[model samples]
Target: MPLTTRRRALSTLGAALAGAVALPAGQALAAERTPPVRPLWRAHAHNDYEHPRPLLDALDHRFGSVEADVFLVDGQLLVAHDAVDLDPARTLESLYLAPLAARVRAHHGSVYRGARTPLQLLIDLKTEGASTYLELDRQLSRYRQLFTTYTHGRVRRGPVTAVVSGDRAARTPLAAQTVRRAFYDGRLTDLGSTEASFAALISDNWTSHFTWQGVGSFPDAERLKLRTIVGAAHERGQRVRFWATPDVPGPARDALWGELLAAGVDHLNTDDLAGLEAFLDAHGTD
Candidate 1:
């Protein structure tokens, strides 16, 4: 189907699904009961845990990717932006893993009903990488069936693909593992340095590479550079995402998002789930 037609169908289907489904924690909604909506795979929710409903909100928006910052305090992985704001009640399991497992089950394997693509869960580690990742590995093992796994040299697709971000030290343990439930989030420097099974995503700070904030014309050189980066990553079968972009609701954000889309960037990071969803809908994204 045409991209425009697919998006229109997705919007209508999504509206119906949202009204019909209630994704409460640990409860499974019958996704098969409603027609599936094509998710905005390029729409990524940055700081997704901060939303009123955490993972559920992103799902309701039909976003294919969501980011969570995790801090390892004591033994539990707590979800919070900063240590001071950490709430013991909010945990990685309660907030993300368990809920995702339930949803995936309801959808019959995929996170979205009738969709084959795995949902991207970008888990940003806030504490020391080595020790924290050890705990993370242990936790992810419990839900191995729910996550894309790497065993020996092969990758098995699952309902969700967890990519570990933040704290470069985590790479050490991750590399040592013969089998893992998560993949490493790579930076520009790591591009093409490792196989896609190891580094599935190439991410970097938007400000570090580009001066354009979407206010004016994008520099010809920078535009080329952006495309080149994306091309190089894609050539190696790695997806690309750039954070720290201007996310305020305005033309500037839309302009940057448009350019990123034009560049074939895989994920558009935004805290405003509704804004990005509307933008993608208006642009007739598939």
Candidate 2:
């Protein structure tokens, strides 16, 4: 099936999943505490801002990571994929930050009540990387306790870990931070170029490096390349995620997801929230 057709079908599936899985009661009851659920550590919600419920939807399925693209507009960070789709009310603080803060407090310093792993919040840059990241740093400072931080030579764990992606220029300013609440997201080439403290994640488009689309048997050479990249990233204590892979709902997509897991890929990127949740749950990744 064509990628577009698969996306449409997956979007429909995602909508249904969002509707069926309600928000956790812990979020609604900030004062009342509830035990945290097991997190799907490998699950990463791609373009999570597009979801009807944003962070909540992924949390409902216990996703460990979520991506949000933001444009630095009029001194405000607005969440959207493109300039034409920007909405004034869809500020980063409203859609992600504040809600996360509330949830962390509700869960008592953890995104998923008692889960030790901090949730990964990937902020893909949609504007100039340096200036936008500086502004983002300012915003992140307001919720210092809510995010993981790196200072001097020590790393402090918080409920959420913000990793900056997109425009490569952000790396310059990010590298200069003496104390930063956000980390950099690098490409596969950056695997051994820097330490995990600087670039916490290594992410790139899967199609750019591979010719296969999960059709028949994956080429042995390509499979080796995939495993090599993952192994290198893991050796450095950095996580790996490849976006723009097969997201169409079918055997091909399932096959690709399976390969990713078997190869030790840290994240399974998908727009279909429930689709990934079910796949991981069934496969025992939960």
Per-prediction TM-score to the true structure, in the order listed:
0.89, 0.88
Model 2 clash count equals 0
Single out the weakest 10-residue window by summed lDDT for candidate 2: 27-36
Clashing pairs in 2: none
Please provide, for model 2 over 1-286, each residue's C-alpha lDDT reduced to its tens digit, 9 standing for 90 to 100: 9999999999999987763424577765753545457799899999999999989999998999999999999999999999999998999999999999878865667888778799999999999999999999999999899999999968998999999998889999999988999999989878889888899899999989998898999999999999999999999899999999999999999999999999999999999999999999899885
Candidate 1 lDDT by residue in tens digits, 1-286: 9999999999999987763435674444343356788899999999999999999999999999999999999999999999999999999999999899878766777889888889999999999999999999999999989999999999999999999999999999999999999999999999879889999999999999999999989999999999999999999889999999999999999999999999999999999999999999999994
Number of the top-ranking candidate, with lDDT as the measure? 1
RMSD of 2: 13.2
Clashes of 1: 0
Clashes of each: 0, 0
- For all candidates in order, the CA lDDT equals 0.93, 0.91
